[model samples]
Target chain A: MAEVEISQLHKTYPGGGRPATRDVSLTVADGEFMVLLGPSGCGKTTLLRMIAGLELPDRGSVRIGGRDVTYRAPRERNLSMVFQSYAVFPHKKVADNIGFGLAMRKADRAVIQDKIAWAAGLLQLEDYLDRYPSQLSGGQRQRVAVARAIVMEPDVLLMDEPLSNLDALLRLQFRAELKKLLTDLGTTCVYVTHDQVEALSLGERVAVMKDGEIVQCGPPMEVYDSPASEFIGGFIGSPPMNFLDATLRRDGGEAVIEVAGQRSAAPGSWAAFAEGPVRIGVRAETITAHRAERSGALRAVTEVAEPLGSTTLVTAVLGEQRIKVQVPPDFPVGAGDDLWLDLRADRLSCYERDTGRVLVSDR
Target chain B: MTAAGTAAPDRAAAPDAGVDRAPLARRRRNRMLVQVACLAITAFMAAPMYLITLAAFSTRESLNAFPKSFAPADVSTETLRSFLGATGVVPSFLNSLVVGLLTLVLSVAIGTPAGYALARHVFAGRDAYQLFLLFTRALPIVVLSVPLARFFITAGLSDTVLAVALLHTALALPTTVLITASIFTAVPRDLEEAALVFGCTRASAFRQVVAPLALPGIAAASLFTFVLSWNEVLGAAVLTLTNRTLPAQVLGSLQWSPLPYRFAGGFALLVPALIFIFVMRRYLLNMWGTTLR
Candidate 1:
């Protein structure tokens, strides 16, 4: 139950061209689940390592529970971490692995036993307590690793893609369990993952990172609905948001963007900008398919149709750019069909054409 | 596919099938041939050791007889007792034990940290250091021993077991470091980092996590050191006179000794090494983890 404050943290390996982490600042409030989401080599793990005190930052500071501990060793930090590799000691039994931190702190035997039993029961690992790590399956081993971290009852917990090694079904199963467990404990956690779905499902706040810096940080839906930059917009979704370049205009006090030989009303907030070039980003679900005769709707020639039982995804080409529009499963659309896309103005976000930052209105 | 599906119902009668018996007989013969070859090699390796043990425990009359018998006619303790009673043999035997143990301790203590660093740390000249270790092995022990003997005498450390042990440690260190480095490399750094996050320091993490996993490999290296020091004659002879190791003492007077005395002394020198290997056999098993079958 501690707030983790990291400010201006930077780390660069010698001989590397760029810093691994650069000027990254973040504050995770008490009992918050903050996920650092990014692709590989994006410095999320490096940031987590620096906070754990396993790695030293080249610049700036780390404060845990309001105490500066940037220079302290990992042992002195009083925090626990679950590694991506599920680094349970092979020589120890599952019980011993989960109780290692308490043993390191020289806790009483009864207390250590109590904590180990509690964590194991919570993880449904009580049956495997006496078994060695090699005897357990991947998912079970990951649970043991989580049990090991949580048994310490640290002020904060750091996990670095702890479910990445498990198979698809196991990852999904453990992902839900982990979310529930983290909520039950209510300990401040800083988790790192490349999976956007996991970030959206587990994070109280998601910080999307790119090239060693935080590109956008907000609640999952906020970051999704209004990404601060083009990079965040593209990286945070499955079939990521679609971007179309268009010239904006305000005809008769109604804002609209002209694209592919047709004019469609822009997202409502774009009215703040004077008529000029802007990039419009709309999620797949926000763009709906309609009959070609609809007035003021942009026309796109459908390239492919993927009907996924409950919904159909139609990828269409509009003015030399590809955009995917989510439609109803029974929607009458197919490859080579010409249709109108009703771009929901209220659901769209507009960014500057060159700078890629959102055009925020004072209102 | 049809044959396999049809054969499933007659599985009980399939064991007596002539078609299957042909391949089964061939496989059995091939397996027998492989076992025979392995046993022959094992016998070839074990014969000399068995013969030496037999001769060492046999009567002097039997050992001296021409066209030596393969089997012991009369097993006796006379030859062993006389070899033990030989002047300077007992002291040299004790000295060899001390030197071997001391060499093992010194090499492992000095080489383990260097080995671990070479395995895990990235630093300037790391490859150069490894190359230097490999290059040291190219130097002949005999070539260095003479000068080392002169230096030891000048330093007033000659004619003592300590001098021989120090020389043995220096000779064994290169191999020790390389072997231990590979061993440490095999123990993942992830376990150590995990230990650190669980509240152990870097040193304690290595001790608590890495060391247990690497114990078998380290034990192998220690056994190598002990055998090396136990068998080394040139350096031990050159470095010591009064406190000679068993190998140096035996080799020094080898030609002059009778056949039974030579065999008995050789067997006596080998007993400790055999006991050591047997004692460490459990740790030497390749049981590190789940990666291997």
Candidate 2:
């Protein structure tokens, strides 16, 4: 097990739009599963490739186990990678593909065979070692790609959307299996994916990237509970967080938000906060749908109600603005019905309209 | 979308020919005509090659005694042995092998990498180089031989098999590059990247991964170059005398002695050409496959 330190890493492509990776720095401790999470073209793959030494960074160094390897060749760096395309050797048998690195290192035949057998068994491929890639199914090919990487027993393993090619059922199954395998082998893995749920489920710490830089990096639960910015708040959830345009005013030593011409009185604990037009974001679960309440935030009409089995999602308009809330499926709600919503003040995050910076906490 | 759709037909009114016909009979008739024409062309091309093979294997008596029969009455080793005798034939035959091998080696080493660079890497004057190679190939050998022979004489390279081999390589380069370039195109660039990510160095990646995969097409390209060198006589005759290739030796003596050995020598010269074509038939089809795709 070995930690990776990428210090001030920058990659400027030949034909520049911007730096593909702009002064990004991150550290992963030994045995930590860190996922570089982002949408397509966000430079997550470039970061992983650079860390693998398959790509060279323009202006910074990548160190593994405290050894600098920015200019090292892939073999010299000793990191195994599984590509998004499942880059298994199509011309080789499963056994040879898995044992490719061992063969390169001039390992003995018996050792290679035993290692190949162990990897094959770990991936549940006892019967297909002699088969070519063209003869296998998509899931099997993915297993082969993973098996090939793991058999090398390198210091780190970089996986670039390794399950993106598999079917949904197979992806879920393999994701769990891969997590277990990495844990058992005690290899540091840096997984890259755009799926936030996959990052949450797999990564011990998820680093959210956008526009060639990491905007937030934290434990998955920490990132889920307290997003750092408006972008992160809107990006991390399934139905996403609800944000309504509002103006904050200081009145009688409390912060009051005027949303859609209706003033939402703050809880008095947030009285010393900023006072101006701002955007208020609340997660879907934080906005509770009730008939009417005396102590909480607002009264509104439920515009659209969707009963999604165990939980229900209701899109409600607080005056001129619409927001979504998760409630019980059997909650009394339907389209064009009036309802009351108790906005949880402690869980609320307010962002400045001009800056989009989260003012709730240093999250 | 409607605005864009109207642009194609606004200039004309008589548009009956543009509509697809719905009748099955017309389509079937057109298909049948195409099939029959295809069959006729296939048989037309097959007939000459079939007759040539019959004549090549026929005995001297059977070849001379008739309205040429499709079935020769006799086939013997006497004519084969005489055609491969030591006095002149064996030396010339050995010369053909050497020239073909040299031509194959030289052309392949230069052509495949040139093709890859053309297909992949982009640099200034690349198109100019390609056009230059094409122009070199388009010049007929007989036209260039006059000036080339003078240059060879000046360099003291007169009457050598190497001179003829170099001339043949120049003739084969354009086809070799074009074919191998198309073959490399069919194999994905991702596979090359995959090899690099594995433990291979850049050159080792090419040697271990890309080379084995490109072998069939390279084999076909080398085969074509060898055959072209073997069957070449016009330049070979001008370039060499003591080490004349088989085609040069045979073509120079074609009519002076109409002995059985003469006909047999012609057959012997034709044999390797036929073998090369047969060996590369599948890959030649693959070349077309890759081209169309």
Q: Score the docking of each candidate (DockQ).
A: 0.72, 0.44
Backbone atom clashes (below 3 Å) for every candidate: 0, 0
Q: How well is each residue in A275-345 modelled by candidate 2, as lDDT tens digits?
A: 77788888899877777665445778888888888899999988888899999887887888877777776
Expressed as tens digits, the lDDT of each residue in A1-363 for candidate 1 is 799999999999788899999999999999999999998999999999999987899999999999999989988888899999999998999999999999999999999999999999999999999999999999999999999999998999999999899999999999999999999999999999999999998999999999999988999999998899888889888779998898899887778898865799876666779788888889999887896668867888999999998899899999898998889999998789998888888888888999999888875
Off by over 4 Å in 2: A265-270, A291-303, A360-363, B1-34, B54-93, B116-128, B185-190, B231-233, B246-271, B285-293
Give per-residue CA lDDT, model 1, range B1-293, as digits (tens). Answer: 12212223454566555565566556666766777788799999788788989999999888878888888889899999999999999889889989999999999999988889988999999999999998987889899998898998899998889999999899899988988887888887789999988988888898899889887788878988998899899989888778899999998889999988889878987788788778766645542322211
Candidate 2: residue B259 Cα off by (Å):
12
Task: Pick the TM-score winner.
Answer: 1
Candidate 1 chain A, run of 10 with poorest lDDT:
A265-274
Instruction: Give the Cα-based TM-score of candidate 2 against the true structure.
Output: 0.85
